[model samples]
Target chain A: MLHFKAEIKENIPVSKNHYLLTFTPLAKTPVPLPGQFYMIGIGNSCDPLLKRPFSILTKSDDSIRILYRIKGKGTTLMKEMKTGTVINVMGPLGNSYPIPKKKHTPLIIAGGIGIASVFYLAEKLKGKAIVLYGARGKHELLMLDELRGLVKELHISTDDGSYGKKGTIIDLLNEFHVNDKHLIYACGPKGMIRAVSEFALEKGLKGYISLEENMACGIGACMGCAVKTLKGYKRVCKEGPVFNIKDILW
Target chain B: MNLEVSIGKLRLKNPVMTASGTFGYGEEYSDFVDLNSLGAVVVKGISLTPMQGNPPPRICETPCGMLNAIGLQNVGLKKFLKEKLPYIRNFDTKLIVNILGSTVNEYVRLASALDEARVDGIELNVSCPNVKKGGIAFCADSRTLGRLVSKVRKSVNHSTLIVKLSPNVTDIKEPAKAAEEAGADAVSLINTITAMAVDLKTRKPVLKNITGGLSGPAVKPIALRMVWEVSRTVNIPVIGMGGIMNAEDALEFMLAGATAVAVGTANFINPSSTSDILEGIKIYMKENKINDISEIIGGLLIDNPDD
Candidate 1:
């Protein structure tokens, strides 16, 4: 991993309380894979202290994009950033999503801001995957047009019934026909991911789920962002941000 | 022009060392930092057996700092000697292993084993606040600290024995003096301060451990004060650390009578913090026309009316 200052290319509001930030690295960095993340420094000050972790939303030769919600001090500060603002970035960290077997069909599930973690994976699937995207309302369903254009099939839901089939993403999953031939990839709140984990297990479907936690050193040194699993506690910044669905204890 | 400093008989090429629990095994940061540039690399706190650490939500960012309750998770002494030791031996820097244990025998065993392997230093971690046993217990009382240090000192023949003191105590000088009298070569202070954070929405503690050791720029002033106090109380060299983020902070520790300084939380913020601080120190020395880094040790000047 490399740590260098990157100049912001764009910071645009995508949906309610959500934004897409793109930056060009001042130094050459390894290509980041889907499901991998970068720790973005907030400001040039120590008040916010630790760098915030963001998943790679998209990447090109010159710039990389990350979708974030203004939920805390770090993101709020990030939203005010304009083009040409240089910020420290350490990246292409953690493991990437595994490719589905040739015989298996890819099924991607995302909830609310969790869409940021899987958007790059959808792009990699190259129109071969089916996506189930959900949010609190239609305004929070970010980058719908772009996601639809990339995937072979796209389904959406909102808790407030302001958009596609009302209710949780788990409710929408109940109507879908899933089996061992379908490979599931998910990222969402703990409740949604837990429900999806159980659903995938019941159907005997193999899958991977991206996890999130408050982290200190984005490297393995701090051991701060640990998540319990069948084998043992794993660092979310190192051992994962993505894990085999069957491996998670909860 | 000289940056060399001695901790007991161990001579470091410079006074900048990576704090224990922050630098890992020296390999995790090899890609971002040149281990050869560091004066010393103090690995994470190791125990007799591998520890799993605390549960999730082990850390939370606070104002100007962060709280971590990692519970001293380590690969155990066996793994360190077999796997970690060999990898770090490739680097030109001195290696100091930070050891933790539940009893005096455990500490003695870890010290002798590491000394037998010929590591450069052994830092006794008696102030890690996250664990339930062995850590803060030994250092809470000066008497107990003295006994522990004396026993560990006996087992350590080749390596330097540095007792890492706790800031949670009433007076930091007691343990520093005790460690010195008990044959410790040097003393490092302060470990993270005991602190906590709460979530209003959930009405619960932010960390599953409820409380964690506070470190970062927030604790720097307190650490500096404690280092100054202990440095005056003890004859042995003082290794100062706690939220040392930049060269200015590291230099401040030296002015407060610290012979050497360790970079801890700054490593998490910037992986190359130790190297950066070392380079900054050199620049500071050159700009001020200071020839030796030792000149800055205990350099703080307090005007006296009598003078």
Candidate 2:
């Protein structure tokens, strides 16, 4: 991991309450993996003290992208950031989703803003994976055009009937023929993740899920951002922002 | 300019140190900071056994600061001495172990073990509740704090004995004097002030622990006042900390009577805060034509012509 300044190339709204921020590193940085994240510092100020952790949405030759929703004070400040402004970034943090086995086909599941964590994986898998993207409504869904072109099959769901299929992402899963031959990779709200975990376990499928938590130090130092696992409590920032669905106690 | 400062018999090359629980075991920020450049590196609180700490939502950001209730999770003493100690031994800096315990004997044992390990210093984290004393914090009562300090002081032969004071008290001076009277070589203040944040929409506390210690620029003024009061009350060196984000803040503490200052929450915001603050302090001394850093200690000029 490294700490360096990166200049913003773009900070544009992608959908209602969602933005796609792109920045280029001034110094060389290691290539971030699918589920890995970066802690982006806001304007140099004491209030809003800690940097906010964001999952890597995409990475190109010279730049990286992060998809964020303006949830609180930090993200609200991040929205006001303009192009060409410099921000401190520490990155390629936490573990990544393991590669799919030869026998198992990849099933990428993303809910709302959680799409940020799985987008890179979908892009990397390209024509080899099927993606199930869900949001509250049509306005909340993001990167549909890009996702359609990247994955083998793209399925979408919305809580309101304004989008593809009505009901939660779990209801949308009923339409697909999933089995042990499929490896589920998911990132979403706790309810969605729990449902995915149960779905995977009942289907005798193995999978991984990415988690989100309020973090400080984004490194292992603070021992904040803890999540319970069968072994005990583990740091979401270190032991994971990603974990095996089977290992999770819940 | 001379930046050297002494904490008890231990002389620091500079007056800047990394606060416990913020810097990890000195390895987490090694990529961003030069460990050798720091005056001291105080690791996270070590207990007799590994602690799982609080459940998720362990930390939350508040205006100008953050609240953290990490529950002092650590690798336990055995793992620390075996794995962590050797890793940090690579750094050319003094290592001060901040210890937390539920009983006086626990503190004594930790102090003597760390001293035997030949560490540079041992800081007693008196903010932890003394389970033996009905869950009241060791620093909550002056006499209890005195007894704890005296026992740990006797066990600590080589390492400098420093008592870390909590600001959640009626009068900070009482505990400062109690520590000195009990043979503590130095005292550091203030550990984070207890505070909480609530989610209005959900009507719940932000942290799973309900309340966490508040640390950052928000607590600076309170820390400064407590440091000033404690410095006047105790004869031993006062190591001030709690919201020291920059050189100006550190200088403010020194002028208010602190011999040294520790950088805590700033590390979360900027990994290289300690080095940056240290560099800033040197520049301040050079620009002001101050020769020795000791000149800044207790340097506040108070004048009352009417008196």
Best by TM-score: 1
lDDT of 2 by residue, A113-218 (tens): 9999999999888678899989999999998999899999989999997999998899998778997888999999999999999998888889999999889998
Where's the lowest-lDDT run of ten residues in candidate 2 chain A? A173-182
Candidate 1 segments exceeding 4 Å error: none
* Listed models, DockQ each: 0.91, 0.89
Candidate 1, residue A158: the lDDT equals 97
Model 1 DockQ class: high
For residues B69-174, could you state the per-residue lDDT of candidate 2 as single tens digits? 8888789889999999998999888899999888899888888899999999999898743122212378989999999999888898899999999888999999
Each prediction's whole-model lDDT (CA)? 0.93, 0.90
lDDT of 2 at B277: 99
- State in Å the error of residue A101, model 1: 1.4
DockQ of 1: 0.91
Model 1 whole-model lDDT (C-alpha atoms): 0.93
